[model samples]
Target: LQLNVFCQTKPTIEASTNIQFSCIQIHYDGLDKQMTAARLNLLNNYWDVVHDFSADESPVANYTLLYEEKAVQLQSAAVFQNSSVTFERSKSTVLSTGNLLSENINQVAILFCQVDNESIVDDPKEPLLMILDIYRQLNVSFVKTVQTPVDAATMRNFVNPRWKGSSKSKAVMAIFIWNCTDNEQNFFNKAISSNNWVGKVNLKVGSDAMDVIDEVYKIIDSNRS
Candidate 1:
């Protein structure tokens, strides 16, 4: 028997600021009835009678081997059927409960299954890989927040080396702000449109730190292009 499982968040919005997500499970049973019956007895004494007839080891037994084999086959079928039914029913409940917290935050979440990279000879570039590469180049100390929204003031404070450390200890930080309101979006658009952001790569002081930032922007550009 082989089992495959996967989980991931979905991309759908709800209310003013909510999103939805899912998870999936797959299984494959490859053993024949005779093989399965034999294994069952090997693993436990409870199936001794079934295995004895299936393996033709007890020819002198009063009961017919065909009848005993049929009974054991039915039992195995019933076990697999019951397990599959329970699993499908439980899946819905699990997904609902797991994402309940997100509901309050106006978001829906799910676990998704994807193909393993090892299984494929040729794999395309993805945003996740880009993010991972950028993460490796970045200094750990500079990571103040992760996957959270921030205001303009917070952004300014994060970028200012003087506020957090001395010139020698300063590190370049990247902040990801999300779940912004319409007003916030407008503000960002206006700021960028008016060229208010410096948008300059400052490598004079923190050359190594700025290199990481440059790599991150390059990834962003590649993703967009």
Candidate 2:
């Protein structure tokens, strides 16, 4: 007596799991019903993939064979206050939540907190790459405050050196600390609105870090093309 077995195509994507097996009848003719009945033996027995299921044993199999599989979804975010400081977001602030080495990220935001011109030159590369995120993925950077907004020529020169990667590639947003009393902060607002901002980038000004971050979330969560 011979038994025929067949298997169907299995999933290959990293997300797929679980395989189902079914019993298929092949012999329906005058193959003696008693003979088929005898094939059914003990209810439980040791089973092996290769012997029982005739599964593919080749090393270079096309489908993924999971011995033990587990799935867990993880949320991640990186934030930097300054070169050395890192501010934690409040749970109320973050609905969910890296040098974020992926500068080719979909969006980029340059944040202007209070700053003196001295540290701008020596700012670590890590902080520039790292950023705060509770919603969508984007890059955030900090810049030195100037007393007055930069002109078109200055905007081209001033924004690039501090910004890594292609300036025009990713969507850029500039967020500055805007207070009527602070001259530098006032200028920071105007700097972001230069021709550089119009259609290519987003500009937001707020009184404090939390306020700026809140606007950041709005921009990131928005669906404006």
Candidate 3:
């Protein structure tokens, strides 16, 4: 048994790279380079070497590692040092959003889906309103309205593909404004269960917009795999 490479060409020749193993063949266009994280993922490796285990201090939960002398008293932004106000106002959130939107269109993006007004709950108007406020404030490229729940197949058409050979490209993420309706919930659950999409996305449901965003951010932070 031996690793196989069916074709080889100069690096400047950006054509497809072909690989075969006797009965099996895989075709990959060599136009762009794969990112380090994705390359590791294909090798069945973890994104964070410190993780790959079930622990409370998983990559996302644990603070980013920094090296300094106890000289590493472990200093973070004062805001992050406190528990009550850690997320009350986060510079990281603002910075990440700005960077994502400002980058090339081929890269990162946010898909926002607004649930039908009629489907909205009469209660929890405050939380809904907050979400609306953030929506309005965002430098939106596009807003899609879903009158009813949709299957994952329908969403595939709009979602930009993420995992390509291009090192520069990234996954398309989405913010779904849920009305806490059973039908919508069921639709998403079914779609997730099917899981046939090419580009991967982490869809999390929460009571408020903030909660879901927080959860999504965690996934995004650790999604190097």
**Number of the top TM-score candidate:** 3
Compared to the true structure, candidate 1 yields what TM-score?
Answer: 0.16
State the TM-score for model 2: 0.17
Q: TM-score of model 3 relative to the true fold? A: 0.20
Q: TM-score for each prediction? A: 0.16, 0.17, 0.20
* C-alpha RMSD of candidate 1: 24.5
**Candidates 1 and 3: which is better by TM-score?**
3
lDDT tens readout by residue for model 2, 85-132: 222222111111111112332232344321223332233112222222
User: Can you tell me which runs of candidate 3 are displaced by over 4 Å?
Assistant: 1-169, 193-195, 206-225
Question: 104 in model 1: Cα distance from truth in Å?
Answer: 39
| Model 3 lDDT per residue over 1-225, tens place | 121111211011112122112111222233112322222111111111232233433433322221110111224657444343222222111111111122332222233332223313122232223333433444332211111233243233333222222322223334433243456445544443443331333343333333434444554455433
lDDT of each: 0.25, 0.27, 0.28
Q: Write one digit per residue (lDDT tens) for candidate 1, span 1-225.
A: 111112121122122211111222122343223334433211111111221222334334322211111111133556676453333412211111111112122111111112123211122122123222322332211111111112233223333332322222212223221233456445433433343223421111133333433443454345346
Tell me how many residue pairs clash in candidate 1.
Answer: 15
Off by over 4 Å in 1: 1-127, 135-145, 160-225
